[model samples]
Target chain A: MKVLEDRIRQEGLILSETVLKVDSFLNHQVDTELALEIGREFGRLFAGQGITKVLTIEASGIQFAMAAGIALKVPFVYAKKKKAVTQAEQMYTAPVTSFTRGETYQVSISRHYLGPDDKVLIVDDFLATGAALVGLVTIVREAGAQLAGVGCVIEKGFQEGRGLLEEMGVRVHSLARISSMAPGEVQFVDHNDPIRIKEKV
Target chain B: MKVLEDRIRQEGLILSETVLKVDSFLNHQVDTELALEIGREFGRLFAGQGITKVLTIEASGIQFAMAAGIALKVPFVYAKKKKAVTQAEQMYTAPVTSFTRGETYQVSISRHYLGPDDKVLIVDDFLATGAALVGLVTIVREAGAQLAGVGCVIEKGFQEGRGLLEEMGVRVHSLARISSMAPGEVQFVDHNDPIRIKEKV
Candidate 1:
């Protein structure tokens, strides 16, 4: 978590008062050394509860989920944005709105991959409005699977994304929690809720 | 490579003669354990290239690239299919046609990430018509970066992908080469050229 927080300070670019671009180190251009460490940290936090699989939406979340999957010795599933050519008919679907892309799309998982017997840990790069997490939670419920928890590299705490997931009784763990992203400065803002922050991890 | 071939044999499904799906364990549903091994194998193939970075088109490629990036201890960059709000103005671009999506789209990389001094290894989950790889190569060339090589988990030998990459003078290594996906079978194609298949870890 410290590695991620330090990297955010060093390579994460503040694009505006509301958005931070981690392209130099996180999403676009990935720092694998840091990803490995972050993956290990997730492994530490969710050592139990029988994580049968790691679920994530495509693109940015793919790498992080794979990292955690390796650390936790669990397989991962990527919810594709596009309909794959060989896709099956049976799948669980949910709608999601992206704060960054400014689009609402359907995210789905094949029924063949996820089932009622599975417990899933959801992972992603950033948690801003919490819509993506909500989408994943919806898909998990559709499959009759148990939600192990949610893990993120960075959480925009000022956005109150945590409250949305907490309302669903889902534990959210974020390596770096941003209190505010104003101009050139970023804040950690997680010590106020020690128990919740631990749940975030 | 044998492991990948075995995985395909075990879980890969063939839909029609042209479309094959390994969504059960490759891209859609990822086996991180196998992903790690494939990453190490790739590191062995491109070991002395002095690769400063690994590059790929986003969605499916991100996880594989991240694993290889970790194995090689380098940073990895993934081009975006959809533009993010935090994306920069200066960028390198190329057009890629997606078979599944049945459309042509541009893949973009931030100018801040690519440069003349960088050694890049382009990676992806599958190589079909080579459109994505070629588009990725264009972005790399536009930035004047050294393309160390290209790596893929699967290559459809019946398709024109490898020939196109070879014509471009870029070395390509595919873990499993599918000669034919005849009706219900996905057969692993053998390479007659030792130069293309033989390498050390």
Candidate 2:
């Protein structure tokens, strides 16, 4: 997490108080080694949970989910942003509003892939606003699958995302939690502080 | 590669002559171990190419690209389907028409991640009409980067993707090359046949 925070400080482009772009390494372009390390961290965090699957939304979250899946040695399922022509079967669906894109899109996963017999760990790149993560949680519950927890690569700690998931009784873990940020400056939630501990159960 | 071919034979649903769904293991619900193996196979194929980077389009291609990146010990960058708010810089752009989605979308990569000094290997889940791959190839070329080749997990051999890439003088390697498929039957381009060899460079 220190490494990630350091990388954020070094390479992250803070456009405003709310928009932080780690595109140089995290999402748009990726550091594969760093991604795998993030996965290992997630794996260490949730090692004993008997996770049957790793779940995430498409595009941005795929890499982290894939990495977590590799670490956990489980299959990872990404909910599609939209239903494709090939995905005509029964699906568990939810709508996610993207504040960045300023649009709401339906996220779906085939009923065939997720169901009651599985335990799921949800992963993603960023947790802000909680829009997409909330949608994924709904789908996981709808599929009758057991929720392991949410593992995020980065979390906007100042936002309502962590509050929303905790209210839903989801144990959340974020490798790097940003407490605040502005152009030319950024701050992370102190990991040593007991008051700011991430996992809720 | 034989294991991949077997997985397709066993779990692949032949939805039509053109659509073979391997969502059970490849794209939607990814088999992590198998994906790593596929990465190793790609590493073996493109080994010694001095691949500084691995590239792919977002959504489905991220997993394979990540795997290939791991195998090659290089960073990987995925082209965004559209220019996001954070992506305000100059980008290498190309438009691609998706036959399945029946729409055309512009794919772009930031000008920062790729350049003349980088050697790139493009990886993807499927090689069908070559629309996306062609767009990626164009972006790589436009970035003035050296493209080692393209590696596909599965290729619709009956389609024009390979021909298109070959026409561009790019090397193509697909783990499984399907000659034909319909309903319950599928056939692969025989690997033993020298005439069906994939690399053209």
Candidate 3:
């Protein structure tokens, strides 16, 4: 986590006093080394929690999810943004509102992928308003699967997302938590590395 | 590549003689061990080449790209499918036709991520019609970057992808080449233990 915070300070750009433009290393232009380290951290946190599947919403989330999958020796599945006709008719569907895109869209995963037996660990790149995570949780509940916990590489702790997930009683584990962002400084939430936390945030 | 051919034989589902569903292991839900092997195989193929960057498209392509990136000890940049205002305006962009979704969309990567000094190896999950590859190549060219070659896990030899790349004067390396697929039967282009090109029926 110190490595991430350091990397963020060195490479990440602050856009509009709030948005962290990690396009060089995190989301757009990926750093496999950093991702692998982040994946190992996630594995350390949730590897022993009977995680049958690691779920994430697609585009930015796939690489980190795959890294975690590799480290934990478990498979990861991402929800497709669009539903191609070739996909199965039976799916667990949910609506997600993107704070960046400023629109609501339906994302779904095939029913064949998730089952009642799965204890799912949801992971993502960023959590702002918790809309995407909420959508993912809806899909997991629809599948009758157990929500093991939610994990994120970065979390904007000043946002309402943390409280929302906590309200659902889902344990949330974020590697980097940005507690405050004023003009010049960014603060992070205090944490003791969690083996497992039942409460979300 | 025998292991890959065997995996296709055992776990692949033939749909309508044209679509072979390996999503259980290759896409959707990824098998990390198999993916790792595939990545190493790619590393062996391009070992002598100076591959500075591994470039791929987002979602399904990210997993394989990351695997190759890790094996090759290089960073990878995945071209995002969606548009965001935060991205660099001077980025190279190209349009691609998708066989799965039956649509055409544009993909782009920031000009900063790739440049004249970079030697890139483009990677993807599947190469069917070579449309996606075309888009990636266009972007790479626009950035004045040197493309070492293209690497794919599975190539549908029956399809026109290889011919298209060959016509464009690009070398392609595929682990497993499928000659034909008819519901129950899937034929592979054979190879020796060293992955030499053997006879193909």
Q: Pick the candidate with the highest TM-score.
A: 2
Which run of 10 residues does model 1 chain A get worst, by summed lDDT?
A: A192-201
- What would the per-residue lDDT of candidate 3 be over residues A81-197, giving only the tens digit for each residue? 778745655778898988877888889898888999999989999988999998998899989999988989988887889899999898998888887655445566774332221
As a TM-score, model 3 comes out at: 0.92
lDDT of 1 by residue, B1-201 (tens): 998887776676667666777787888898899888988998999998899999998888887898789889999999998566777577788888987667898899989889999999999999989999999998899999999899999999889999999999999999998887665456677744322221111
Sort every candidate by TM-score, greatest first.
Answer: 2, 1, 3
Model 1 chain B lDDT-worst window of ten? B192-201
TM-score of chain A of each: 0.92, 0.94, 0.91
Worst 10 residues of 3 chain A by lDDT: A192-201
Model with the higher TM-score, candidate 1 or 2: 2
Global lDDT of each candidate: 0.83, 0.89, 0.83
| Tens digits of per-residue lDDT for model 2, A59-148 | 899989989999999999999999777787888999999967888999999998999999999999999999999999999999999999
lDDT of 2 at A199: 16
Residues A1-201, candidate 1: write the lDDT tens digits.
Answer: 677777777766676656877777888888898788888888899998899999999888888898899889999998876466667567788888889878888888888889899999999988889999988988898899999899998998888679999999999999998887655567687544222111000
In candidate 2 the C-alpha lDDT for residue B26 amounts to 91
Q: What's the ranking of the predictions by lDDT, best on top? A: 2, 1, 3
* Top model number, lDDT: 2
Q: State in Å the error of residue A87, model 3.
A: 1.0
lDDT over C-alpha atoms for residue A59 of model 2? 89
